[model samples]
Target: MDLLTLLDPLMTSPLLYPLLAGLGSLDGVLPMIPSEAAILTAGVFAHTGAPSLLLVVVATALGVFIGDHLAYGLSRSVLGPRLINRSKYARRAVAVAGRQLDRRAGLLIVTSRFLPGGRVTMNAACGTARVPLSRFSPASAIAALAWAAYMAGLGYLGGAAFVENPLLGLAVGLALSFACGGIVELVRRWTARRAPRAAGAADPGRGRSPAAASRGQVGSRRVRRALVSATAAVAVLAAPAAAAATPKEADRVGMRSRLDDVVATGAVGALAEVRDEHGAWRATSGVAELGRTRAVPAGGRFRVGSITKTFVATVVLQLVAEGRLGLDDPVETWLPGVVPNGRRITVRHLLDHTSGLYDVVETLPMPPGPEFLDNRWRTWTATELVARALANPPTFEPPGSAYAYSNTGYLLLGQIIEKVTGRSYGDEIERRIIRPLGLTGTSLPGTWPRISGPHPHGYLPTLRDGETHLIDYTEMNPSMMGAAGEMISTTRDLNRFFAALLGGRLLPGHLLDEMRTPGVRGASYGLGLDWWDTSCGIRVYGNDGDALAYRSWSYSTEDLRRQVTVAVTPDFRGDPDHVVDAFLDQAFCG
Candidate 1:
């Protein structure tokens, strides 16, 4: 099971409410406690019916109220005087309460619950002063309720937008909470700066006569009140819309909205496929190509970029299983002298992107622009490409060092396969995987430029003569990418391939384990496959692909029961990850 799936039971446990309440109670005394995260997390769980929303709010309020009284109780205790006398902070707290808490205590208490450290200081100060229980208790109760409502309400809002991923919801809640605190701080500073000026002007003969000064002060106060009232009114009116977007409504609107959002941001076209036990849902938004009205093809093929790595890695692992290649064997054992540190780099290093080889494409003066356009038709040999990499210093100590993504490493791996089998990498892949799996929609186009059958036209944005131009980059030689990336496949073909691979149709169990084991720090890479911790808490394993004009991804749960695939042609302004996250959250989290 993925992390979120394992965490769901814990989040929904009946014991969670009391725990959250306990934390809330402590928050009044222990300002550092992350009560907001706990409350918001519980509130997020409420969206999934893990717990009732009313129960969560009430529990949170009860905890905070108990904590408030506990601090007050401590203040009235025999040791209260000694404690206040010994601690400078406590003495200062009392001074602050004496000056301001007498008048604006209610507002300060309510807002302080949202501010870090403010709750502990205020509650402690109020207790140290021995303020009447009658005066403090009722205000504390109301303040607790308001804080609970705001925290829970914000959590619910974020949960609506990010239902599958409680962590993301928590982060969003914290950001919103912090933003509220920041706005309050800014307003306080602004008011403080205005106070001295207003006071100086109010003095007789300082700027104007007493009558005129009084009128000016009144006008200034009126303007400040209007500003504060307007801000409050806008927030009150906007609250309902933000809180009312239910999960079902979010699901209904999210996918299309994400697609439209990406398109509007600059994508020429976007398409996605989500598959689960229920069935598959396909969606498309934006045009197939610029200046065309055709919708993106429903089952269109696009270059699956580095996604080809998975297929390549699978075949290599198959060879390892067949006793034809050794994972620990040095690259020098196959294509001797090709890489600078081939003797130190193992086959495993190549597969997991730990070879530390510098990416050959980075050496070029420009990529995917006018400079690349000049050489777009040039074919690149794998040996020639590796030589270009060798010409540069190794990116790091190679052969099992730091993780660095290098197309050069995969190209060398492809060459090694050719050396071992006396056949091109594409031949071995087709004979072993694609043909046997009946994936007719997939192909290694090599030097062939035209996309056959139904395919969306890929686009690349360029600047020429101070104006942006969308170029049709649908046709290009794949020889430059070679075995590393030059493959074409549709969403249907990708889904089939990943599902089969994850379902154990492609490799034995041990090899599959190896493929899923992340070997490098800070990257969830395992062989050609990688893992994504989605916004909805589930972990999905897949590879993402990026070409000059097209981008694609194929991901599946560990059990192969759920999957998502997407293809997009660049519109130049948005990242496809947002749409992918929303779509996968709905598909897998639900």
Candidate 2:
């Protein structure tokens, strides 16, 4: 018998799954591990009925998830980050992965599992970038499933074709995988060749933000020289210099110069505006799109993700101030039987995510591949989402005993708003905040998927059938987020709203005081607003929002004298947090 036939007993062994899981997890930290080959070999045995296809898929999927987390944990730890930052090659790989993730996190995660060394690099990059576990976990799971499916499918087909020769089946399966890899490389090359011409033809009106462009051009020569010199050393000094500098001397650092670094970190497009006593300083970087070289508009509108929570919370607080709803009142008083422990769950619990409700998004079966594209546009109602959350039991016991973020709580809050006000949350927000503040750039799109004004295309990257594809997710129904996170606003509007609210224009003093009271982490969450203490010991209050392809951040100093609002259209290309955090620190601490 051939070598493949000889290994049949081991492949069918019950220990196979655990072995794969162990190898897969180890492969995450060490890309050279032959986890893929072992998996493929297992597939060969499955073809001969020595191991079941289902078992093989399950084993590998778990293995991939476990492995990715292990790598991510390593990167997140102090020693790992230090080692990675110290290595030039690791940093470069991380930069590439960050950029890839900016475009298509799911696609890259799934496809990387097939390419030798791809998984290790991706996990390291994600860990280095500090991409939140909430985002990484689901994407990793989807990728694991895809990898299992693809490998098993190929093995099954080969087995069916060569029933008498498992050896030939294994060879056929391995060859097909290699063929897919070749196609991916070819497609990548073609795209690169077309990029320059496409960029050159882009409209000047759509060019990079002037300040960002100026900053980029000014330091281009110096940055290039530094990058070249970095080749000789494991760590680059220039990057840490700016980050390590004292806060008092921030002005000397130059805001424009910093924005250039931010753009270089992998943001497709970024715009930052700081309004202070001196006046206003605005900067932009990268391009509006990958192929187009246009700058982001001065005040372009974009999805404000969870930042919408602040607005929703503001309205809720307004109701509380007006004595329409009590903070301690049970949610059942407003929406009867919607929540499992409605009586024990208070309105404050909803706002702070201490309601113990399970996150609805976590309950659904989020499939990878083209399957997600089908449901991308599907409209979901608030009632439906609450039902989804209710389908799963509460994640914690004794409501409000612990802190956990639950979008379901926000949706429930939205329902309560409707019950108390007898109007949609959008209408209430428009009359109370948007119209009052004259935030013309902001709107509640409701079920409308299209962004109405001048805006950058929100790009999502994916790998389907072994070829990378960039998807324009610029438009999609926000009903899925509901009151929790479906609002849209520009950086300017965000700045205005936060400034006005913090300046004590939005709510009564008593309600505002209550809103700012920390319910979790001693300071992170208030009634609806959240605060973060900068590295330099200054506290900034605001909310951050994120969608599949767009992210919005708005924050201001405690005094509201200094404020910065940023909008970023993720290109799936790089880690932009370093730039963002630096800008915030300079804006506040400085």
lDDT of 1 by residue, 480-508 (tens): 77767877787877999998899998899
lDDT of 2 by residue, 1-590 (tens): 76655776776577888987777678778877866467666666776677778988888788878989999777644356456546678756755665554332225566667665678887876664444455578888998888778777776776664566656756777788777767765665465455432211221111000000000011122332332232222221112111111233445357656666665665566776777875666666666655665666555667777888899899999998888999999998998877777899899989887888987766542222355466565556779878978998888998878887778888888889989998868768877997789776676655445554456667655447764455667766566776877776777788999988998999988888887787655547888888888888878898776665676678988798888887776544445656777877877766
TM-score of 2: 0.58
C-alpha lDDT (0 to 100) for residue 86 of candidate 1: 71
Runs in model 1 with CA error above 4 Å? 1-253
- Stretches of candidate 2 off by over 4 Å are 1-253, 364-368, 521-523
Q: In model 1, state the lDDT of residue 379.
A: 51
Task: Estimate every model's Cα lDDT from 0 to 1.
Answer: 0.67, 0.67
